[model samples]
Target: MSDPHEQTHIDSVGSYVKILLALLVATGVTTAVARLDLGAFNTVVALSIASVKMLLVALFFMHIRHSNKLTKLVVAGGLLWLAILLLLTMTDFATRGILGVPGK
Candidate 1:
């Protein structure tokens, strides 16, 4: 009988190569997107693309796809923390100009 605790997933070289190609294509797309002027949406678009690339790298290259549920939960928690920090930072930046200083 095989042990349940052992990791059975063995990814192929071809799959890794494909993921690498996809990552390269995503990078090219990011660069292309940066050239155009999209105003406020430019930041949104860039962040969206970056998030996709981050997921791909984490899921495939980092083997998170084959990880157990607990590991996935931990990753989710980390991402949530990052989101909270970014939200706070953006909020602070957005409100900075709302209250004017006496001198300026």
Candidate 2:
């Protein structure tokens, strides 16, 4: 017969409370950062916070921490693809000067 102790169980109430507290703190910090007038960097700051929150959600809420290597690889690939997309978009936007493109 299979041993109960060998299998992983879902998190209990205390564990959930801890995760919720962390999320609450992150939300508060993000809110505070939004109040600052960072001008062009505002989007950058907001995205950074969002990415951190995404990590938290993935690791905890999604229970990926206890998942296998293949799942981790899939998550990494998704993040890498998003990074590539952002890079290409930034390159295109920053290089418009070379092509004599009209004002947007």
Candidate 3:
């Protein structure tokens, strides 16, 4: 049911160009964000921008957008695992120094 050429060939030259442009834009935004002093919200903005860049890389350059079911499943599983690790790490970080001695 599927065309053979579609599976082996990259999406298109345009797609490659798009990927390049996206990378450049992400990099530019990252640089700009780094220069700004957002205080408590600086990390939040950086993470949000980085997440967008990560999504673009994952979906386009990684070819996950046109991949098979198994590939999609693997990507999903990896993301889920990463989420678990991040959740645990954040929890620990949040708890640390929460009940520590005063003026330690």
Candidate 4:
């Protein structure tokens, strides 16, 4: 008998092709955007594009879109941990100026 817990989602080749094309287009857009002078917004735009690309890869290529609840929970937890770490790092950097130089 087959296992009931197994994943049954099967993507077609066309879907994979479509995802590939989309990733390529996003990459091209990222490259093009990098050349423009958007000042501080450049990093924001680049990271936004990158986040979209990451989601596409995760949801489609990694098959997370159809994954089980446990898998989804694990992914969510990982993202939360990453967010926490980033927040802590940013907090440290933001507070660095508050501490005067040791010798000064």
Better of 2 and 4 by lDDT: 4
lDDT by residue for model 4 (1-103), tens: 6577784879999999999999999999999999999999999999999999999999999999999899999999999999999999999998998979989
Best by lDDT: 4
Which pairs clash (backbone N, Cα, C closer than 3 Å) in model 2?
Answer: none
Clashing pairs in 4: none
- Where is the poorest 10-residue window by lDDT in model 1? 1-10
Kindly list the per-residue Cα lDDT of model 3 for residues 45-91, writing each as its tens digit: 88988889888888888878888888999989999999999999999
True-structure RMSD for candidate 3 = 3.8
Could you tell me the C-alpha RMSD of candidate 1 in Å?
Answer: 2.8
Q: Over the full model, what C-alpha lDDT does candidate 2 score relative to the true structure?
A: 0.84
TM-score, one value per model: 0.81, 0.74, 0.76, 0.86
Per-candidate total of colliding backbone pairs: 0, 0, 0, 0
Off by over 4 Å in 4: 3-7, 98-104
Question: Looking at candidate 3, what is the lDDT of residue 64?
Answer: 81
**For residue 28, what is the lDDT in candidate 3?**
91
Write one digit per residue (lDDT tens) for candidate 1, span 26-102: 89998999999999988999889888889889999889999889999999999899999999999999899898989
Q: Which stretches of candidate 3 lie over 4 Å from their true place?
A: 1-9, 97-104
* lDDT preference between candidates 1 and 3, better one: 1
Report lDDT (Cα) of residue 93, candidate 4: 91
